[model samples]
Target: MPISSVEKDLDALTMTIVAEFPVPVRRLWDAYADPRQIEKFWGPPGWPATFARHDMAPGGRSSYYMTGPGGERAGAYWEFLAVEPERSFEVLDGFAGPDGTPDPAMPTTRMTCTFEETGAGARVTTTTSFDSLDDLQKLLEMGMQEGMTAAMGQMDAVVADLASFAAGRAAELQILSDAQVRVSRVIRGPLRSVWDAHHDPALLRRWMLGPDGWTMPVCEVATKVGDSYRFEWEQEGGGGRFGFTGELLESLPPHRAVTTERMVGVEGPGTVNELTLTPVEGGTLLTVVITYPDPQTRDQVLATGMVDGQEMSYARLEAEVLTPA
Candidate 1:
């Protein structure tokens, strides 16, 4: 496969290499975001490269070296000038010594890498700017063209592996089924604190609101089996109010609970919501599993931005309830 093409403009004092990959932009971005992945394809096929230090952020520095056939190491360093996730970044590339220090005698190239999404997949354009024509020619004479071409050529195989791994990781995180929608979070506090945030009316009012400019005006929880609870959120500008009322079916303090939730003005029957908490090393792992009566209802709830709303609410709960308590 044609992976990369290099273009050199001596008069323009620039060298640009563009590569196309059949992978998601995020997977391609991981080639640079992860140092371990970069180490695998940073040099020509035979001269393997190893990174001593890699900090992928604006103003950060990365130091690495390539080992030759005779064990000769060619060290290089990059000073990151700017960084934008899944998009582009700028860096100053230069030769370095074994100690990871920049060598003043070597020419430095200003490099910019841009990642763009396309119909086919993702494309990356890396441009290197030289100070002068002589500087560009000097690097070319040092086998820069062959080195870069061979290095970037390895990206296709690397991206394929990364894409597969990313897909597997995403599948593990997604929680969607015919009858249920599940969400989980690790709250940065003890299990009891997280449980209290759900049962305590005052604490419940602080983080249960769905959207911005909404306040949980009324929150009541009986905290016992066969008991009922109700929560209402009123918009700030007198817009409107919405809430859910439920009956507790099972209660196991600070660990697990089962309840039923019915929207204030919804049409069909409510859903069964199961809440479980487990103690982790430093906090609590809270999981909420909601079983809908049908697939249509489950899809409707998902379409209403329920997942995003819950994520936002969980963030607030962590900051306000977990942190303060």
Candidate 2:
């Protein structure tokens, strides 16, 4: 068991759990920073988790759900209060509805996770403060301690497996739900550069082309929340022309962005794409949570080899735009 101690202070209305790992602090921190890695052990053994959004920055929010053995789900969310990279992070944790809204009936807690170097390796101290003694007792009765212990038990394997989530790997796709999917990649560039590459027309025209024979004829980028952008591509010999248009719904420069995307000439509901970028051990972790109109639409798009095209474009971005000549 990685958990060294679990302490509950009734007077302070807080519970503290300390877990030590046989790895460096950076390794332990990265395991939590990346949604792909953290989701592996965020839930207990039988109840696996899928994170739809995981933005590890102050004022950001993360929403995820755990699936039970019977296929039932329990959703939760974290509103980040502070983030000190590789050191500590604090969040307001609470229950969430299926739509990811906060459950007003459930009690919320303030939790802080601190990382430190230990003689053996590294240690993580997680302290959760409840609003009242009743809240703390209520959670304890709900098997909170047992759930956490079981979840942390699986971290040993995740932290040690570095190759799976290492840099230079191609983009990965995770189906978050019937209508949502998350595409993730570790781009070999700084966070700002990756963010800029998506916005600057010149930078985008250089690498947003998916295949070797394709050329981007139009590259209009949305600069603000209400701005709309369009992009069109064509084959080298002037055949196979297509395009996408979208309106920027939200923009948090260099960290996150949300946009509504649809085919330029298509006549149907569009998809909402939420993109988040975080600095990690190897490079910038880019995550895009896309919400399709429905399961059919989601399947249709994925069936078109969208992920493979995205991988090709990202690889090109690294080799052409981000990389030095």
The whole-model lDDT of each prediction reads 0.76, 0.93
* Per-residue lDDT over 219-288 for candidate 1, one digit per residue giving the tens place of the 0 to 100 score: 8896779998888888897768888888999776766678999987777799998776654333555657
The candidate that achieves the highest TM-score relative to the unseen native structure = 2
Q: Count clashes in each candidate, considering only residues at least 3 apart in sequence or on different chains.
A: 0, 0
Where model 2 places Cα greater than 4 Å from the true spot, the runs are none
Model 1, C-alpha of 256: deviation from truth (Å): 38
Q: Which residue pairs in candidate 2 collide?
A: none
TM-score for candidate 2, residues paired by index: 0.98
- Model 2 per-residue lDDT tens digits across residues 172-196: 9988888999999999999999999
